[model samples]
Target: MHDFDLHAPEGANKKKRIIGRGQGSGRGTTAGKGNKGQQSRSGGKTYLGFEGGQMPLYRRLAHRGFSNYPFKKTVQVVNLVEIEKRYENGETVEPGTLLVKGLVKGANPVKILGDGDLTKKLSFKLVAVSASAKEKIEKVGGTVVSNETVGND
Candidate 1:
């Protein structure tokens, strides 16, 4: 019903246009590609960012901007809801412990986020912990012994 929407009416078979089938279909000899040329031939595909034998837009534009992406470190994150489900009260939560629980694997930097309620008095030894998460953990008699130097955050 919208101007830009493409919706076929009910009972409309909507067969695809069979190009180069026959002349009766109005796509006969040329098939809308015109006479002999590179595009007219079968399997003649063009690579992306290609121009008509001219300099591409990417080449014409100035190479500007700097990215610190390569130097940036990726952080592994976990939520309070999941932590409560995995560990029991008075349990220690470290990166190695998280690996065993399938919460975080490898030596990737881990961060604890506070998004839900937690009642366990667990001990935290993580790379990073949000301010709210630390407050919540402390509120529940949990200890946050974080080493922020290990993570990018």
Candidate 2:
């Protein structure tokens, strides 16, 4: 249609709800606050897990066990099976190459795991190779060169 004829669609512009004006206004008196309670009063609110005059469940339960998950390293993983399927013999495997090959993404450090049989003699660089993975690669006449310590997982 024409630019000058343009207008917002139906209900696109809504009137602001006017509340607490008077009894004539539907949302007046209690202003839709319902019956009297701790919530009906001004600035009356309860903190999370608060129990009225009683101990909260959070305080009742024993705070247990330390978890190392938050502190654990988040490494991008590539499997030996994937390497066997994707690369030719003697090609270098690294995070950048893995990204191009669509095996892994992002800037996280790549860790190679021994998940499948590898028949090709490929070389790995700048990536952590797991212990079992290193064994498989060596058995297949491949080599791994890493700046980081070899991972066990």
Candidate 3:
């Protein structure tokens, strides 16, 4: 049988040596900080972005381009292939409908590009469509409600 009471493992649960107490602690005098300097003093923390009193990396790098226009249109894109696969013949596709189907998100305008063939005659109201997409939709006897029409109405 093992003697559990007599042999409590050596150095188990040893207390941490508290520094800066007195000479008895051995780590007293300089509190283990080693002779005085900038680091030995209190509140010696340096700013993270400090580059040893040199110019920061951000300032040194050259900024090349400038955007003068503040309000540039940022549009969400949907491909014609995705539309062809998702919608049925004679279906009315709109932004809200697309959102409901989890195809697009956010407040950005949606632009549809012609990437695949469409067999179904779908009537879609979109923010923008490629010239090929418009042609394809018209060729298939489908109605494409353009951004201009939407703006007019």
Candidate 4:
């Protein structure tokens, strides 16, 4: 027996208080805009960064620092643990193969770090390999091809 009929009566909703109507509307004349000056006139809206004639905030903040090294290399790193889990035994792994397998992306250099055990022998061409990773690979009868030397010439 709950009443869901709660609503404003017919025509009970007050009409929105309109501005800039005309002098006859009472809200006309200045259209409730008040007496002269910047705000009372038409097209008085200001820009977002404006501070009512004061210096803006953006210009007050400190700006510093410079970096001359523009061609710095950003190498994407992969650990041996991840490689061991994703790769198959006796498979040759390379940057292109890793990219095709969705293990790595882009032309960014790949660095392999030793973090887990390698039970399978894998021949890999990588940009960088840790000493431990290189040793482990060689111990497991795998080959490590360095990309840095290949890219230099």
> lDDT of each model, Cα atoms only?
0.85, 0.89, 0.80, 0.80
Ranking by TM-score: 4, 3, 1, 2
Off by over 4 Å in 3: 1-9, 13-29, 55-72, 148-153
List per-candidate RMSD values in Å: 12.3, 7.6, 5.5, 6.4
lDDT of 1 by residue, 1-153 (tens): 578998777878767888887889988989999899888999987889999879999999999899998999887889899999999998999999999999997898898888788999998985488888888889989888887623222
Which candidate has the top score in lDDT?
2
Candidate 1: give the clashing pairs.
none
Query: At residue 125, what lDDT does model 2 achieve?
Result: 92
Which residue pairs come into collision in candidate 3?
Answer: none
Worst 10 residues of 2 by lDDT: 144-153
TM-score of every prediction relative to native = 0.60, 0.59, 0.64, 0.67
Ranking, lDDT, top scorer first: 2, 1, 4, 3
Compose the digit string of candidate 2's lDDT tens values, residues 33-52: 89899899999998887889
Give the Å shift of residue 68 in candidate 3: 8.3
**Over the stretch 89-150, how does candidate 3's per-residue lDDT look in tens digits?**
98888888778777799777887777788889998886577777777788999998867422
- Candidate 2 Cα deviation (angstroms), residue 49: 5.6
